[model samples]
Target: MKPPLDLDQLQTFITIADTGSFTRAAEEVHRTQSAVSMQMRRLEERIGKPLFEKEGRSNRLTEEGERLLSYARRLLYLNRETLAAFDDQRLEGTIRIGTPDDYADRFLPEIMARFSRSNPRVELTVVCEPTPGLVDQIKRGQLDIALVTHNDARGQSEVVRREPLLWVGSVNHATHEQEVLPMAFGRPTCVWRRAACDVLDGMNREYRILFTSFSATVITAAVLSGLAISVLPECALRPGMRVLGEADGFGPLPDCRIGLMRGQTDQPEIVDALARHIAESLDNISVPALDDATGLGFGAQALGRGRRGTATILPGW
Candidate 1:
């Protein structure tokens, strides 16, 4: 009989694969960088196969590693599920969560409702704020978990969903066609603001920040009312908003990852449970929305494409 794979080691392995680096995986799993490396070495020795290979600076999984991924995932899930099922006590605690109104408006309430049903005793406090401000609150330990669009990859932050950034405008307005584009954007610290400006600058297109607000509704209303247009994730594309691409003389924008970050001081068990729920919920959202939504796409059906010329877009800029 084969010796069973170490469940703890497998957990670390999965985290490394998810985050793309040992340093990041360690941060997510609350382990040291050296410790994660040691676990990987031991795991490789036990399996009698090398699991990773260096492709430049980043570590790419080898054939053996690739094969183990599905099995590892299943084992980890079963182990956790089995353990939780056997536990007699119900989970209960107060979890403070922060997110931008954009996400809060669409997804947060539903997530909160479901989580409450599962964890009846666990109180949840939800806060709405811009991504930049939420990160600051997390760092200060004022918030337990934050749903954010991060410019920099840090922590064991789980990326819940990936969507393209789009230039959205009112159906009634020709805001995107202006010589100096009038736009609504989040404050300076918002990653969307940086991404939108960067893309426009690369195209040498002049733009004016006509309306600036953190509220997604305000921003959406501004665009819908023909006050100004703004850049938004495809998933958040409100109904009746016209997508502006090359046809509208606007450049393509970089994609954004919706990430979940837990506070350093949050109760591990509570945060872990809630995080798992959030991940599952977000995963469920990607498929149908991609297929059913007319303008937004999951790579195949693009919401925005330029007919005249391709705008120079720097990925991850």
Candidate 2:
């Protein structure tokens, strides 16, 4: 039988895949860039396949690398679970995590469930708020960690996931055809709201903010009620929503980036464990394909799964 894969090398590989840079992964894993490169080379040799390829200034995983990623995550998770099972002193503390309401709706359930399973002794305190407030809580040391929309101007964060920001309207509504487009949007501080306004201004499109709210529920209600249009990321797409493209006179928007912000805390190990769970959970999320008929990217059937009462809206903009 072949030699077992090295867990240390596998961890470094996963970090590089998540961060999209060997250099950054080095920083995360507390190794030099050259050391990280050496570990990856050994990993590739053991697998007998090139794991990464140069893409612009960063590294993109090769097909083999993509295939190995799933196995790597599962192996590491199993290792953690096994260790926790027998360790009487397994981490036990309260972790205060903040996320915007939209993110809480789409992502928190899976994250919380997985983290709780692995670290059952730990208590989780979840706070749902907008990104700005979450950031403030992080700065004030009130929150141990936060999942927020990554904005360089706001502060630094570890970017975890990204998806296309699309214009969406009710499938049954002709809101896009209106001369003065009515739109529902988040507060002015929201990056998505600013992006939508800027894009419309550049296109000289006549539009009015029909509804304004910090709550994703309010904005989603406006869109699904056939009263307004809005911009949202891929994961946020829901059954009644139709994505608007260039054919609909809507310009393309920037990608929505989700990130993690950690505050100064005494419980470093607990915080790191939670962070890993969040990253893994978000990384496993599959982006659905765009539908040709209604432009509802995951289709109505896919959106119908386990999404009974959830509102389709942008997360933590």
Task: Indicate which candidate wins on TM-score.
Answer: 2
| lDDT tens digits by residue: candidate 2, 179-209 | 9999898888989989999999999999999
Q: Look at candidate 1 and tell me the lDDT of residue 7.
A: 94
Task: Return the top candidate by lDDT.
Answer: 2
Compute the lDDT for candidate 2.
0.85
Candidate 1 has what TM-score?
A: 0.66
Where's the lowest-lDDT run of ten residues in candidate 1? 306-315
Query: For every candidate structure, what is the RMSD over all alpha carbons to the true structure, in angstroms?
Result: 7.4, 4.3
* Span of 10 residues, lowest total lDDT, candidate 2: 302-311
Model 1 alpha-carbon miss at residue 139, Å: 1.7
Which pairs, if any, clash in model 1? 28-156, 93-122, 246-306
The models' CA-based lDDT, in order, is 0.71, 0.85
TM-score for candidate 2: 0.85
